[model samples]
Target: MGQGEPGDLTGRAFPLGDWGRPAERLDELYRWVERGALETAAWYLADRTGKRRGARVLRGGAAAGAVAGAALPLLDMTGVVGGVAPWGYLALLLGVACVAADRYFGVTSGWMRDVATAQAVQRRLQVLQFDWASESVREVLGPAEGTAGEAAERCLLVLRRFSEDVTELVRAETADWMVEFRTGSAPLGIQAGGVAGGRAAEGAVVPGRLGVPPGGTRPNMPRQRPPEAR
Candidate 1:
């Protein structure tokens, strides 16, 4: 579909007629989606539907406030111009109260939106971690016989260590967001640790020689014995 047009059920083009072309319709759809329309839609579809009712009630309260607000000025003007409307001032007060109540409810909805966004992000990260761990494990241990399984196990151990490290990093980030939301402050910096010693030791081993550095000037000369002759 073109920009701004709402797509049909299969995301095909659907012209919205003189309602400002397909592109405008699509833009409106995206605007609604970003503004919690999907969650609101689900709430409407639920059997219990208490949240939907509550939202309707809040909206009705806001509408009542808006109507009262509009009427208050006219009532005040009439009163000042020698019109005998004793309840005009009271109406103005009620309108102000309604507007304040509407604002409070709006803030509540905003907080709920933040929570929903956080939960969605958490689910996405969990799926990513699962896939990464599974693939890394398979890659490290998917060949050879008997002893090969042991090597794979070692690899998995190292992978889990790294995964845990990465998970801590993610948790720190999540915590930072929470802290910022609650206190309006940034989190302190964290220190980095050295690599795991096991992996470092494994890197030191070389084929046909123990504890030999690659491309170093060490004089290692005896490598003639076959397995049977050794």
Candidate 2:
């Protein structure tokens, strides 16, 4: 879409002069996601058609060759003694060849599946990044006065959540649990956890923290309150 008006949702403009580096980094991440998706789809298609077709052809050829070889033995084994025996030998050879070919080609399916899954994970991460970028832009345009600190806070919150979601997505896809989140690439060095104690007090809500107005709570949502006396 056209980067709409400066403050328009469609435009979602950031201070290009300041956010240029981070913006570029974000774009790079998006590209990676898109590429990964394409690669995954390719792997899937090859696994489904190319690999299976190759295996089928190889198996059929091996079977035919085996039957021919076995026929000669069978003839020799009959009164010629070479007939039936040769046929049996040929059949055994063909069976082994077919099995071996299938085993070799079968590997492609698993490998492609793994590659597809990895790409899917990357795509999920990209989606999270896109959402974070959009949300950050909207927050900046909210009623709250946009300042460096406010922008930073908004960025930090979004980054923190995005990182967590990505980490979880990776773990889910790979079945290996690990939590690793980086913030260097994020705008304003916004990380999941709060800033260091020495740098700023914990939970210190800066004025810039107020980006968008807090939307009205849902009517059915339960409001968390302090525990009452027993």
Candidate maximizing TM-score: 2
Q: Residue by residue across 104-149, what tens digits does model 1's lDDT show?
A: 4433333333333233323433444464456446545664444644
The lDDT of each candidate is 0.37, 0.40
Please count the clashing residue pairs in each candidate, in the order shown: 10, 17
Off by over 4 Å in 1: 1-56, 75-92, 95-114, 129-230
Model 2: residues with Cα > 4 Å off, grouped in runs: 1-29, 36-50, 59-85, 104-230
- In the range 80-190, model 2's lDDT, one tens digit per residue, is 653367566766687777766555434333333334333443454465567766755765576366665565556555544533333332223222101111111101111
